[model samples]
Target: MKKYKGYLIDLDGTMYKGTERIEEAGHFVDYLVRNEIPYLFVTNNSSQTPKQVAKKLNEFQIQASEDRVFTTSQATANYIAQKKDQATVYMIGEEGLREAIQTSGHHLVDENPDFVVVGIDRDISYEKYAKACIAVRNGAAFISTNADIAIPTERGLLPGNGALTSVIAVSTNTAPVFIGKPEKIIVEQALEVLGVAKEDTLMVGDNYDTDIMAGMNCGIDTLLVHTGVTTKELLKQYNSQPTYTIDSLSDYLKHIN
Candidate 1:
């Protein structure tokens, strides 16, 4: 097996399933830590900050730190910053998204903004949607954190940020530039943060559509573990495949050893 110098790992389904811990995942992370393998937990979740994410991973007994977590919120903020310095943004999301934008030296406003960025906002209301629509129609560039239509939870699949973003897109008849997985934007930013070349980095996740595609889009190898969204049978139906496939992280651990 070819060894990878660095890894970009997915969070939700790849690390833990909602509130439950994935035991094998902890072991895999432990192996990475023991070997001092460079890795970053790349997540599409825009609601929680890196500190909160690290806290959640520690609860699962997985070794993680704020510096090792990369979120879509951060990617969105970085994207906006690169496009225009200190651009004014009209955002619809939670604390993480808000903090990312403000910390990146961008201004957040309610009216006549330079950009309208959308993420998962559980507290979404008609007024928020109305304002977003107005801003987009009035010439603000539309951007969404991810295109994930549904999120898995203990209650089952619920509407994700993509679904929420659709409200503004449909209302204003405008298409949004999605920054999260299945798109190259987030992965490209993550590579820069990880400081690893694409040829030497591996993207690992349980979702084929988002995680695997993100790697492929950015010319990185991918590893798909059948512990979450995609099943063995389901993955077989896809024309493209991950560079590596394992039943669990434990299986991959054996190969590294």
Candidate 2:
């Protein structure tokens, strides 16, 4: 087993399922803390801010801090800022996505804008979708926080940001530039934040498609734990495999120092 200098972890299924926490996840984080290994929780959830996400983790008895969390909303804002400075944006999402765009010095407008940013908006309305479609049709660059179609919840799998993002994309016949997992954009940004080389960093999560593929897309090692969406049987269908697979996060503690 190779020692990793830094880690990019997933939040939902990897750490907890909806409102429930995975017990082994706390131990895994403890190992990282005790060894002084650098780590960041990378998530596709765009509804909550970093502080809120950390609070949720703390509730699970998992050690986490706001500074140690990176969200797709942050990635989307950073990506847009890099492309154009202080660009005008028309966004449809919750507080986290709104905060990221505002904090990045981007102007949020009602009508025509430079960009049409979409994330998970639980309060999604027909008017919100209409405005987003109008913005994109008017030539604004379309961007989505993530392409995840469904999210696991206590209720069951529900619509995610990707599902919400599709309204504008299908309406305007424009493909959105997705910024989260399975795309190299978020992982690349995360690596820069972690200040670690790709070869020395590990991406850990339970989902094979988003988490493992994100690492593979960015040339980083990946570990797949079977506590979430993808099962051992489901993973066997994929031709490409993660660098390591474990029954739980506790199984991975032995690989690290």
Candidate 3:
């Protein structure tokens, strides 16, 4: 097994399922803490801030902190900040996305903005879509946090941010730059935040399409745990495989050093 100095872990399914705790995940994290291996919990959910994410993890009995969480919202903000300083943004999302854009020193406006960013907004309205589409057509740069078509739930698969983002794209005939998993944009930025070389980081998650692919897209090693979205049987459908596959996070303890 390859040794890694840092780890990028997925939240939802990999760490816990909704409000429930994943027992093995706690132990795996504890091992990393004992050895001082750097790790960050990365998520595509742009509805919550890093501190909110950390609080949820704590409720699940997982060891995590605010700075140890990275959201696509942050990546989107960082991406925009890099492109132009003090750019004006027209947004379609909730608190997390709004906070990230503002904290990164960008302005949020309803019209004539430089960029239009779409994230998961549970209370989306036709008016919001109309304004975003109009702004994009009027020459605003378009960006989406992730292109995940669906979000998994106990109820079933529901539309994700990408699905929500398509309305504006189809209306304006423009594609938004996606900055989350399965894209190198977010991963590259995350490596800088984790302060670890890409070659020395390992991406760990339960989903093959997002987590594993994110690592592969960035030339980082990946470990796919079978506790989440991708099962052992389902994972074989992909051409590229994760560097390692384990049934649970506990199964990975032996290799942590």
Candidate 4:
């Protein structure tokens, strides 16, 4: 068995879906604890704060703390802090985005200033889209946390951040500077938070486009678990590859011993 000293793990599709926890996701954390491996729950979902994520994980019986998770919302906030004017942002998403910007020491306003940060908002409406479009047209820089077009739920796949991003793209004739997975910044931050070097780290996820690609982009070995968005059949169809593939997190432990 290949042993890793640390991990950068995806949360939504890799660990759980919506409010549903994956089988053995709690056990996987126990495995890490027993092995004394450092791991960070890294997520591109900028819709929730670290505390909120921790609460959700805890509700699922997973031992997660705010310090153990890193999110794109925090990254976006940090990115905006270094901008030219510390731009006042018109946010079109969840409270998590607004809270992150405020926590980063940047001002967030509804009416016109500098930029518009968009993330996954469950309450997405046409008015929200129109406001974001207007803000972007008026020269506010458009920033998207991630480009995930759809999110898998027990009911079905639902529109994700990318859908809203596309609207802004067409309306403003501008593309957003995405800060989430498939991009290097979020992964880098995750590594820094876990204090792990790339060689000693493994990334476990279920998506090829975001999770797997993010790990590969940062030179970390990727594990694709077939418990969420992607499946073995889909991998074969797309010719997508992962360093390791397991039917599920439960089956993954069979090789651990």
By lDDT, the best candidate is 1
The 0-to-1 C-alpha lDDT of every candidate, in the order given, reads 0.94, 0.93, 0.92, 0.83
12-52: candidate 2 lDDT, tens digit per residue: 88998777879999999998999999999999988899999
**Alpha-carbon RMSD, each predicted model:** 1.1, 1.1, 1.1, 2.5
Estimate, for each residue in 164-243, the C-alpha lDDT of model 3 and write its tens digit.
99999888889899999988888888888999999899999998988999999999999999988898899889898999
Give candidate 2 misplaced runs (Cα > 4 Å): none
TM-score of decoy 2: 0.97
How close is every model to the real structure, measured as TM-score?
0.97, 0.97, 0.97, 0.87
Model 3 residue runs over 4 Å out of place are: none
Off by over 4 Å in 4: 82-86, 123-131, 153-155, 254-257
Report the alpha-carbon TM-score of model 4 versus the true structure: 0.87
TM-score winner, 2 or 4:
2
Clash pairs detected, candidate 4: none
What does candidate 4's lDDT look like per residue over 197-223, in tens digits?
Answer: 888888899888788888888788999
TM-score of candidate 3 against the unseen true structure = 0.97
Q: State which candidate, 3 or 4, has the greater TM-score.
A: 3
The candidate with the higher lDDT, 1 or 2, is 1
Judge candidate 2 at residue 37 and give its lDDT.
Answer: 93
Clashes by residue pair, model 1: none
Q: Count of backbone clashes for each model?
A: 0, 0, 0, 0
Tell me the spans in candidate 1 whose CA falls farther than 4 Å from its real position.
Answer: none
Candidate ranking (lDDT, best to worst): 1, 2, 3, 4
